[model samples]
Target: MGIAELRAESKTASESTAALLRELVAHLGENRTQLREEWIRRITEGRLLTAMSKDEIFAEATSVYDSYVEALETRTLEALQAYAQNLSERIIPRGVETHEVVGIVLLLRDVLARSLFSKYHADSRLLNAVLDAYEPAANAIAITVAVGFVRERERIIRQQQEAIRELSTPVLQVRERLLILPIIGLIDPLRARQLTEQLLRGVRANRAKLVVIDITGVAAMDATVANHLVLTVEAARLLGARVIVTGLSPEIAQTLVNIGVDLGKMNTVGDLQGGIEEAERLLGYKVVPIAEPMPA
Candidate 1:
């Protein structure tokens, strides 16, 4: 037989031996009483048919007893060898169903002789069924692991995104009703465009009355960035939101002043607190302590 056949035979032998052992264990319960009884019945029936002389009868009975003993011993040896092989290979020898044993036996039979591939393709149906039984359990485990990983990844990504957003700009809260967006990163055309959309949406949704854009964080700006800022301010105005320019460092202030950027139409403040106080003044509210005056 080919190597494949030999291997197949070996597996079949292992499986069969295991199955036989299970059957034998069940059969031999009660101190082998069942086996003993069956043997006794067979022997008794055979002895009754011996109607020959005493010597002939004695010889015939002895021969039958010896044959039975030898057969039992041979079977015992084969079973012991099968058990040992199974232990070495880590095969669970007991509790196997008939269908499993049948499958293994079929495989073993195929291995004993070499033939064309089409003549005896190993029937995959049995193995397939076994795999099918395990599919749902395996898939459940895989999905659980995948979902856990995805949740963990999403959490990590959200944390990182929050950090980036925070570092992108300094938020100036105004009177608990308005916010001044002071962008720090480069206000290139793309960023300016995105900021415009965000601010407009925020102002309308929040019903903001004022937005003081502090430009001190801006390191440098080209004409395009400058023009985008102008357009952003105009859009906020159209949405019924007032705009204040603040945090104008000396250098930027000088540049805007020299460039003749129009400041006559815009309200400007020097710092964030100053801007908020100005907005609160315009709204006719004063933040003061509610305590009686003390006299010495």
Candidate 2:
């Protein structure tokens, strides 16, 4: 064929593909409820979406279905990505797994393709063109959704890790120039590093001269933990903050002694109250209870 004829044929094919996609989008919009119900049914029967209630499933399916139709109409992945990010934010905290999210997207593709094939089986050429256009668009949308979901999930995980780090090693200022860090759980090397960072930051922030590390809630201590504690005390001293180690259980004390980890230069207290008292004494303050006013 001549170049002009070939160009014309290509333009016609392009127009045809665009028209078919619009038709598919229209069909999806018109039959949304039916398609969503089928999608939900398939997802419910599958392994991934068993925990979700029907209402939850239907709501999410409706959102995804409508977004997918919009994406097809616009021939862009933006709608799908926005919908996926919103869905991920809602569902990840609800305990929906990543694979489950991807599974639901695949299920939508399956249902739509099946419905399309059933309606257009008589016209092979048109059916082929529609499928060719639809499959890639659907797959691309699914991939975009999955990517968005995964990125959001990763962000949530990072946030959770930061929160846990803060919770695991909280430094509190109980009085002027006095700070207390109550270590309630097992301290590993990583946590020890986090604790040291928090302690130093807290000391600087509070202008603390004394830091009381109360370990009353600690369950156990090993050589590594002992080493971490010793390092923390030494670091605090370097920062000009005197460290008081308190609430050392008999077991932990023996463990520390057996490991030959010496904390002799650091102040020692029997309990949290003792630590507080010592901190106050070092700061030259005493908590004197005020007498209550006589009843009227």
Candidate 3:
């Protein structure tokens, strides 16, 4: 064939494909409820969407079907992407997994393709063209949905980690010129580093003259943890804050000595109450009991 004839044939094929896409979209729109029902049945029967109610399943299925049809008709992927983002946000909080989200998209694609093939069985050229457009669009939709789910999950994980760090190391200003850091749980290297940073910040912020580190909640200690504690104390001392170690259980105390850690240069107290008293005494204050009132 001549170049012009080949160009003419390609144009005709392109136009024919567009027309078939429009027709397919129209058919899907007309049978929207039926399509959604079939999609939902397949998903529910497969136990893929187990946590969602019937209403929720139907609603999600309808939205997905509508978005797919819109994208196929308009020849744009933005509609599907927007729909995926919205769907991901809605379903993520409902405990839907990423795999389930992608599975639903793939299932809908299969159902729609089956419907199209059944309707246009005799038109081989049109069927081929439709498949060419539909398969890529389906894959794109699945990818976009998966991306949205993963992004949201990662954001949630980061938020949770931040919360955990805050809870693990809490600094409190118990009184004027006095701060307390009540350590709880295991103090890994990362948490120890975080604790050091927090202690320094708190000391500067409160202009604290004394810091009492109470480790009553700590179940055990290791050599590395003991070193972290020593480093934190040293850092606080450099900032001109006197640090008093408190809540040293016999086991932990033995651990410190067995590891050849000499806390003798630092002030040590038996408990939080003793630490508070020592802090008050260093600040030149003394607590005294009041006398009882005489009976009238």
Model 3, 1-296: lDDT tens digits are 22233234335556666676677779889988888889889999778878899988888888888887876677666666677777777877888887788788888888988988887789988788778756655566666667767887788878889789988878999898899999998878888888899999999999988999999999788889887888788889889888999998887888888887766656789999999998887776323335332211
Model 3 poorest ten-residue lDDT run: 287-296
Cα lDDT tens digits, model 1, 74-104, are: 3222332333233222222223232332232
Would you list the clashing residue pairs of candidate 1? none
**All models: lDDT?**
0.50, 0.82, 0.80
Candidate 3 at 13: error in angstroms? 12
lDDT of 3 at 251: 79
Superior candidate under lDDT, 1 versus 2: 2
User: Deviation in angstroms for 129 in model 3?
Assistant: 2.4
lDDT, residue 134, candidate 1 = 26
Q: Give the distance in Å from residue 124's predicted Cα in candidate 3 to where it truly belongs.
A: 3.2
